[model samples]
Target: MTAVDPRRLPSAFWYLWTAVLINQLGGFVILFLSIYLTQRRGYSVAFAGLVVGIAYGGGGIVGTVLGGAAADRWGRRAVLLTAHLATAVSTVLLGIATGPLAITVAAFGVGAASNVLRPVAAAVIVDVTTPEQRPRAFALQFWAINLGFAVAAIIGSSVPDRHFVTLFVLDAAATLGAGLIIFARVQETRPARVDPAPGRGGGAVRGGGAVRQVLADRTFLVLVALAVLFGLVFMQHNTTMPVSIRQNGLPPATYGWLIALNAALIVGGQLLVPRLARHRDPAHLLAVAVLSMGGGFAVLAVTQQVWGYLLSVLIWTVGEMLHAAIMPTLVGALSPADRRGLYQGVFAQAFPIAALVAPAGGGWVMDHFGAATLWWCCLVLGIAGAAGHLVIGPARRRRLDMLEPSSTTIGVKARGT
Candidate 1:
């Protein structure tokens, strides 16, 4: 399969890419919110946990749906700028709030404000690129996110305890910088709305359109359900894996190094994804990715050794790389051009929802049934997810193929056909 050049993506995409990198680099608050709340703000651990889980997590989940609808109604550029600017403001508010109530509200704002960008940025990429260029485009965007995250993690760690406010300032500044870049460089990319036939009602209907359209899309809903399963298995690394490693007598630093390895592998291995996925069916790739992730955790079920843990990390990270790049494109392919933001938003919400559920679910399984049981469940879930994708993939492919002819004909006419 021939490689699609990333260089061919439009300037608008690059601007969006750069903005994403900047925003991610400044994403210091989420990583340290719990720590900051417990240590600096005099909040109890339980309170901090609640604040993070309920206020921030809930805000993030809500943001996707709101951001998607707003982007469809207003335009991608407006939503992107609003989210960035609002995040900047909220980060600063979180830094300065003295009371628990103030901090929680600010944190909620930060969460909602920041998460509003994910679907909008994804929609912009879809608007600017042809289907052929999309895989590479999303891959590059995913690479930027991880690259920024790696650097931010290092810089954030080096920050002094007394200088915690500095982190907030820096994060807000970076967010604003991203907003400025978008304001100056990026153009609105939402597809124009078309009126109904002359004999039809010709009335305008707004609000809840995205929700109705998305809910009615059974195939897309199936895809989202599969993603939730994959995410539940994948998110275990964050919640349960560390506990299991600690139970095995490994230090916290061991888990740290293992996670670092995951990041490093992604930073290095991600660029190859477009080429690796070239000319392949996305559903097939997604299935393989799910199996790899599930199998990785299943490896953890059998062994407690460091090498085994490392092997598990490697396998799951491979799945991460493959799934990260392809999933957005699949969401884009399935969505109508006009409602890309809403569709992307709904798709983006699947992981955060999984994140919310995985800890309790995996922890319960581990406590009652044992870690091995959880791992085995992951394997079963992975197989089930893969089978679902295989079943729905052909239908999605047929729908996309039907849409392609009209898109290609439009392109030809635009080129003076």
Candidate 2:
């Protein structure tokens, strides 16, 4: 359409679709890594979890912030390319690692490097999409991820149950594939010509300074605190939840089904968020999401039946859809172009950091208090996140609006996707 119409919608959609395919395919290793460690490698559930949680969660925390900063300080394409290269190497290593230490190191590297792509890629979307079309663009990406997850789950289940290293090989190839597609086909979506402000240096990606910026923004800091808290809870799906499900008498396929359902809900919910977001700010939306997560987990505390747990998975998945879809959109909308990647990177660290603690803590809790107790932790963290979101309020919301990417009508410039 015209430059005046911020929702240059179609351009963003196609690109988003491509990103989703790459991301979903590259991501299967993360979902299936634990199965490899415990079922194939012969580690206890706790130890296998310790490695997975530490490797993925720890690496993700470090990478997100770094990726964002690199995107801002360098250029989006440069950082994204570097991230892909690193991801490819690390994922390949996972397939070949022979010992626990080597596997842990390899998994961590993969986790960190692979995660770097997300914040930077998101920043690109923020750089290109208009405020009005932002929701649709993000939904397109989210849908791709879930769709990919659906396909990955099918493959993961159909393959021999304990074929762990195969997942890594596939993950490695996916990263390379995504990079090739971008290098070969995905256009340089960021503006070719930039007008530099007097002191702002060259207009490059600028997010490494997120700690300073978040310090200045009272609301953003509060929101981060809440996210970190919720991560402590939600991370269970990867860490403790797997342990619990196995103990509680469900197969790995059960988790496959639950996660598939989770992805499906994410796709459905993200598509709806754009319409719903027009009527409500991200903070308000986040509040509802957090509350739903907390309430859902609390429901899990009392149930021991597989069917009962399935209902809990359903409840939590709904909340996940609302939160998962909107979070990046919020970050993209909050940071200045110079700092977009940095803020998102730093924001991404929360879950990874939580991954480090959640599994070990949950394992200890399960060892001592039993499986249901982990849900209590989730319950507390989710509620706190909701409250923290409530504190982020309307003024912070305005800053997010300003952050919506400026639109371009020039045929040379790529659209939001």
Candidate 3:
């Protein structure tokens, strides 16, 4: 594999990357929300799960679609700044709400505001970097996210339950800081109008046209479906895994450190796996990665000890590291330059889609059948998603070739790994 220097990427990417790291560092509330609800607020596990699903996932679905459209209609910088400010305000709202209704509404606000950043930020990355550089650019971005997450996990978990408000305030402050950075450093990168033909990846469409076009792309839809399945299996770590840890008699801090370990591994090795396997067929590599995730969660079904959970984290983290950089790059490759935000937005919805179903579904399953059953179901979902990816891989590659011929020709001396 060829080596690519991180410094070679444009300065805007670094600014965006730094802002992402800052946002994530203080973005610890979600990780501990379930725990906070169940242990601190005295909500039942099932109810907490419902609230998370409806508030976070439900709002995320709306925010994602709107944000994608807004990114295309407005500018990326504007959308990002607006969303960041909204996220900060909502985070504080969630912290102060007293009753269940207020809390749920506030959480929904946080979900919608925070999630709006996904498609726009992803669009910014696509806008600023060349195709050959995208993989490494995204890898670095993912690394920053997990690095912040690892630290947030430790800090959020270590604070006493009573001081959870401090976490919320800090999260809001960090979000504001990230927004200010974007306001200062990042510029508008939404592609200018090219041609009028939507079929040929041309200029931006007005009103519902972009949404209609993205929905019309059947191939991208299949990829989105695969992402949904992948997310379902992976999202269990937040929704169901914590409950499993507690049921096994492990403290919340144990879960925290375990999450930190997952991040540590990713931060340390995310760049390495992509470098080593850069030449492999991406579909085959992704299938193997998804299967590893399945196997890891499958192991979780039977393990009752911290060591067993640690092993589970190690296995799944490998899969996470491998797929992190490649998926978004594929989304960017598939999109027309003009509609990058919408395409990325539609793709981004897969996780929130999973979030919507997984928490509620996993909770119900665990409440009735047991945690083992839920983990086993994750294994099944992983296997199914892997098979689908294998079948669709060729079509996706052909589409990429048709859409981006220059993307395959590595002319840039500063090509990403």
User: For this target, which candidate reaches the highest lDDT against the unseen true structure?
Assistant: 3
Off by over 4 Å in 2: 1-13, 191-211, 394-417
Better of 1 and 3 by TM-score: 3
lDDT of each: 0.78, 0.69, 0.84
lDDT string for model 1 (116-210, tens) is 89889988888888777777778889988877776666677677667888989999999999999999999888767644422212333467755
Candidate 2 vs candidate 3: which has greater TM-score?
A: 3
Weakest lDDT window of 10 consecutive positions for candidate 2:
408-417
Q: Worst lDDT window (10 residues) for model 3? A: 408-417
Ranking by lDDT: 3, 1, 2
Model 2 residue 378 distance off true place after TM-score fit, in angstroms: 1.5
